[model samples]
Target: MPQKNPNPKHKSQNRAGLLRHLNTREVLAMLLKHGGLSRADLTRLTGISGPTITRTVQDLLDAKLVEEGEPSKALLGRPGKMIHLASSKAGVMALVIGQDACEISASGLDGKLQGNLDRFPMPRSYSEFLSLVSQKLKLAKPKNGVKLMGLGVSTPGLFNLLEHKISSCPSIPFLENQMLAKDLEANTGFETFLLQEMHALCLAESIFGESRNLSNFAVIDITHDFGLGVVSNGQQLQGHLGLAGNLGKLPIDKNGATLDAVATDDFFCKTIARLADSKIDIQGAINLFRGGAVDAMNEINLMIDHISTGVATVVNLFNPERIFIIGKLLDAHPDLFVNLLEATRRKSIKASFIGCTITRSKANSRLGAVSAVIGKLTTGKKFSLK
Candidate 1:
């Protein structure tokens, strides 16, 4: 008996099939970006063969992830049929958990919000919090054959993805050590994901906002607490245990005061109160700055100096294409970007400062979390669509 011969052509065919299957995700992502595309357009954009585009688009159509639109007129020969994501087929829920409140919203695959954002006060007890979330999930269920994809949560402090637990949340101590993702999954019978607020913001920016075309960038969230989210080579950096962007821990001064201590809204408010000899909160301080009070300006400059020091370190180390500053202060005072850029340039190297745009994040935490969930679905992650 002759020894069985392995055919090289058979192996090549198998490899080709696998590659086509993988290309399905790429096709879907492109459709999402461009809203719609013809087979020829897809072939040109993705560099895949015309036959492969037809096969991938057919597979997506079979899965109901995409749908066919009206054909386009052609100058010669047959017109082309357009393909686009089926936004009405499925929806995702986003929950943004803050210290005192939580925001929940539902969105479609096209990234358009399905309904109004629902705000709820956060309960102090972990059990109560879980109950509240469960109730909201029940209320957010899709109707008329629309599937519920999954839930994506954005919370403050350190989250350990491997353990599925929140390791630390200084503002909401009750959340520490809680298996939030697992709990949400178990309670709602749907896939759930949890991310640090800053990381979620960065992912949102990369997917739909200012950093969409950027492969490398840093998102600095300066709220009551300072946090950093670094994206390198188009991937969000999550260190061992998912604690990579804990910028609050970065020491800013010789006395070892961290960035969180020196560059937060709370810090600025307290500093203004002390310097101006008046009891004023963050909003009041913002008002004073807007009023052009010399004392308020001086305090803001001091805060910017510390913030610039931290940003300079990030620029020198990461060398990202952009640095996105996000917080109430930046939102209220758009002019701060000018001073921030000046201060950062003074502190950083000339090469580091060049081509690095610093801007404010337009998407709020709620929108960022929603975008994250939509991103997960587009990336072929597992989720419940029930």
Candidate 2:
């Protein structure tokens, strides 16, 4: 269905270009980590040759992916021009797909949002969702000269890296086994990558939240399901098929009840509804607890115990230096975070819990989306001039 290039010299040139692009990505990644660096710094940090660094930096400057900053004062010799990401030269788009809604936002390279977040109800089917996203992206295209780099999606589910599709998503059955990232890229013409929601939150934590400088930390998402994301030695621990954090079905108790069976937003919501003998949302249940309703308080305490079990398991297993829990149920009350912290410390191994700090996460999925785009553009894959 397609034509192939037969020219041997053309193939060699293309290979050379790809190698150069990869070297440029390595330079960009180094810049992203350190914020600003001189040409010598890049060469030293990346182990790239001085000439390659010079050529790569010039190409980046021409592409507007990087800009020259003030000259640095050299202690031993002449100063060098500092290179940094051009925050205003281009922007990236973030799409977070939750059970109830889909959030779309655009941010500059500096990770600052350019405009207000736009949200839409979750479409009923895959085709409908694709169409909606495509249409919305068309309307959200930048009118200014700022080029849009790519789109990053934060989704709640297990993504099959081997198959390049969503392998499992209980909340949205329509997403299972769907090639979501590839389809989005095909439809929207934006470089797209999909990550589990918790992974995104983990990235957000590392970039913008409390885990910024920590080399070992864990991010737990206790929403409709229980999920875990871990960072060790400054790298995400993605096991086979990037499914290392699939903790929903983990057997926590001897009774054979799964983690999600006892500790989940849906479980808490349903338990409170049954206790109150009425259909109520999670926030309403929190309000009931705040009002000193005896039944609500009991249910809340039990929910905390379940959450502590999950958190304690994470501590004992991963031995993370810090743990961040993100959930509406966890943030419902001022005392919940403190109570959970104390309870987790009690349940986990004393040595493992010694220095681990359990805290509530303030970072949302939006930052994760932004980090995803930056990661793809700089490190995930080789880029193209086209």
Candidate 3:
């Protein structure tokens, strides 16, 4: 038998590592953004040569990063085979650390639900949270072919990815400087990421939501929490320490009432209850606003003023193209959004009433638990922590 050449240049890449590389990354990004397409489509989109495209795609298929679903034949040339990421392989899991509890779920790059949103009691410590994340993955008992890529935690905090520590997480005490990313990664032997909650929402929205076209826009979420997502030049404004777009903490109601202090779900509940002389949860306050309770409307109008103050600050600073408000206030006061738009016009000197559109997120909130995983996978090297 002839001695075959064992080339050092052709070292094999494990299934996951190969897809995580450049050529397939280009292909993955194209398929993710433009939808399923044939090799010809990918070559055109990436500006790569046909031969390189063929070889790279073959690598993806062999590594199972991508798979062929169908062929498109125009009859004028060779049939084009539709290629897409092999989502069938182990799905990504995300763990959302909500204010109250935690939620874990699995989803695909298409943002489709793969598993039920599994709830875990809010852990007291960052360590506890890390433990539950692994516990849930174990409980899910993911079947083979669906290799677990890794996990991401959605929490209200600042992640200093540089330091690999959560610089600050007031909402979830003890998370400060916890080095969650490193800890989780070391313990689980899988890549782990920590992301700000609303930023994650923004990433999810930017990929598939009202903010799709507005690359330089911001998504200001007002729900149980108050946060903003800044998307700039087609990427998130994850400033130093992962604390970019934290508009909620900005001073608004100088009466010591910050945006989150006065505009969050807790604020609504407390203010509504105090004003109405009755306890009203977030939904009830929303209902009360919808029912057109005169007092509720009055309070809501005042609240919108504070909201406009917060938004004005953001507008003057970032000049975002859109400011999305995800809360009952939008459902109640169309005038508030109109008023904020007007305020934004007045506050920023050069800021000419940037076309601001405020509305609820088009993507499911439930994706919060799994959305980060999708983001990490699709974000490629520029943002990939692993």
Candidate 4:
């Protein structure tokens, strides 16, 4: 259906260009991670030759992907020029579509937030959702000639990359079978990517949260629903079916109740209402728990027990360097969080729990989306301003 390239010279030239592009990407990634570095530093860190580093840095400088910073003050020898990512030169847009709301933001490759984050009510239908996102993306575009590199979307579902569609979303059923990334790209004329919300959050944590330097970690996101994301040996584990962290579907009890049914916000609210003998929501339950209500304390303790069971399972299975819990329930109750850690430590193997740290996620869903886009950009994915 397509013509083949017959010119060997053309193919060789293309390969050379691709290799150069990849080298430039490596230089940019180092600048983004460590702030600024001189040519010598890049050569030492990357183990590339000084001449190769010079060529790559010069190419990046000419392309405006990097800019000269303050020169290094070396007392022994001449000061070398410092290079850093051009944080204001270009940016990527991100959309975090949650069950009830959507947040759109644009961020630079250096993980700096560029513009005001826009929030809107999530639409009920798939078409409406796409339209709303398109409109918001336009509003979130950067000003002052800053290039828009691409778009990143974070949603609650299993994204089937081969099929180019979302396979399953319990909270937003209309998303099933929708080619959301493709449609967004077609509508906005920008390269687009999609990530499961938990994966996005885990990426954000790995990049900018408490687990920044940890090589192995797990993130348990417990909100209205539950999900898991794992980073083993410095790589995010997306299973064979892109369903590695679907912990909600895993049975947690002998009766076959899944983690989602037993440990989510809805489950906690219902448990609290039943225990208090009154109709109460999540915020109300938090209020009661904070006030030290006996019934609320008992219900929260039960919740901690269940959550600790899940944590123990993760620790035993993955043996991560740390575990991060993200949710309003854990955020609102510090004491409950401590109790959860203690209970999990009690249940897990002593060796597994020895140096494994468990902490709360610092970034919200919106910032997580931004981090996802930055991640792709640093990995050498193609993008454009137009």
Candidate 5:
């Protein structure tokens, strides 16, 4: 016997609702990228009907998701009122769990930070971390007319995507095997999402940094560890398990040493300290290099060689249009970043190398954390009518 179809009206309604949602999303995305637009402009850009665009704009205004602005005097003839995304009317709380300190910040939907970044010492235990977060949440009330929509955490480690739990965190071992996002959401009564630091950086670049509006790019993070974040065809390249950008583990030598194993921040610091016969931090090492310390310069050069190799691999494999490098190593000398770019070009395939622009990343981890939350709220079916 054939199975009976159910609810034809419901199916039709669902289809119509989906189309409406897509139209709303298209309008919002256009406004986000281009700032304000008249209903007529949105209709022309989105290829939607003028009546539908006006209706959608009214709906968004009524929902407080968008606001109308003064008519543009630049346009010829009768100017239409401009509609802008209500980025300031809603915001998200972002927490970045780092090796040295945990940073918390808030940002509007526009990806602009609302206030100064707050930093606290890294908690030694999971319970302590939660207690600190809870304390902060109590004081994190939204301003008048602004809604705190969600929480976003940018952390360093491998994650079990299926479980929404951290699988391993070398810097903060207490976080391993913990359902951090679930716990935070349950406690705070807000939706929560976790992103690895590299992925967060990717989102940051795509949303607010140099890669904005560009679909193909890569972010190489060399701050604490070597990692890569690839955005291809306008999507972050997370592997099946949500752990795709571990570029540090790429083997670059015949002796089986990984990129990260030999070229870590700790290794660089220790190597410089040993060479100088004095205990020194990364900044001090940079000072030594500036003072023409041969040994310090040599160590920096060696690390740059490894980093360039890693970058070349990314260029060859991903063919990203731009590659942004993030780390303090780039600040060691005025010529260091330039040297890395030149070295990467020499090692990469000539055709691929010519197409990719390599530059130092300017976005910070705090921005990355904020971008993660913004991305969570704006993308896919997660964004909804009020």
Candidate 6:
């Protein structure tokens, strides 16, 4: 068990070590974020000496990590050229997990797509999932020469950041809350990173999606499951065991039904199966909802109320700037948007909570698996202990 309240400052050298760990790209990122700055400015901000910053900047220029630029007038001394990360070269791999299959995406370190994403369906066992992950990485290596930095994986399960183990996850039965890092590295020839699907959603939202400007926000993925991921005060607050924002099992109905029970893919399929007297596609249910099909509408309304209760609980607890709803089905049938919003507002504790926008994920539902793969590719390697 991890000691609670352990300090993170030990590995860092007051400041210089922290700056040193930033790497060439991270240094450039600092400059780009603070606007054009001299090496002296960087040294002062990062606590690294001017000389080290000078050498690192020169190295960056040499490696094309940064490009030369005109000097900014803010420099009191000789107008040194400012530098920034050459976004084109940085890359990452994303691993997206699904109930029935897993997807992989190779992205630039800057989070841009870098390769053709491939899908690998899941087998019933953990070993099979491991084999599938290994096979997918081998199959998806870039033909071009982009060095893979690491692998990042997202799963619909809880993660234990303190122990680096997955504590308990009902969606994925393969992992027994154990550390699979070694097994992953051995199989993929790279360090592996595993994060809760909700946490990864937080990353996507913070960097490139709707939660970009919000200090506190919630991302609810209404897909095969009602998975919820959160960010509070601009930082993700993973619980002691990294199960901070998982709300799928929360009982929202007065009868004590869980959100997953009320609104998951399984619910959708079964509801439609009985309503239509035949199997219905997940996407097809929306059209039926729009057509005023009594049973479909009733189910949709029930789901909205159930979701509203969960969202209300999240809002009352954290009061985020916005709420993002993402899934293959929701994004496609944005026509249901108003009904959801209305239900959420009506059921929420605050009838007048300021500045919360509920929206869908920008990444397409079809791309969920690919995004997961790229997510793993980018983050997996770093979480490994050297």
Best by TM-score: 5
Best by lDDT: 2
Q: What is candidate 1's TM-score against the reference?
A: 0.85
Whole-model alpha-carbon lDDT for candidate 2: 0.82
- The lDDT per prediction is 0.79, 0.82, 0.68, 0.78, 0.79, 0.64
Task: Give the lowest summed-lDDT range of ten residues in model 2.
Answer: 377-386
RMSD of each: 4.0, 5.6, 5.2, 4.2, 3.5, 7.1
Q: Residue by residue across 320-383, what tens digits does model 5's lDDT show?
A: 9999988775776888888888888889999999998888888777777776656654555321
1 or 2, greater by TM-score: 1
Which regions in candidate 4 have their CA more than 4 angstroms from the true location? 1-19, 71-82, 210-215, 254-256, 269-288, 292-295, 381-386
Query: What are the TM-scores, per candidate, against the unseen true structure?
Result: 0.85, 0.79, 0.82, 0.85, 0.88, 0.75
TM-score between candidate 6 and the true structure:
0.75
Candidate 5 lDDT at 214 equals 86
Tens digit of per-residue lDDT, candidate 1, span 199-249: 888877876787777899999888877888899997788888776786787
Backbone clashes in each candidate structure, one number apiece? 0, 0, 3, 0, 0, 31
Per-residue lDDT of candidate 6, residues 337-376 (tens digit): 6777777777666643545777766743323323343333
User: Model 4, 19: alpha-carbon shift in Å?
Assistant: 4.4
Model 6, residue 265: distance off in Å is 4.5
Report the lDDT tens digits of candidate 3 across residue range 27-57.
7777777777898888889997898889888
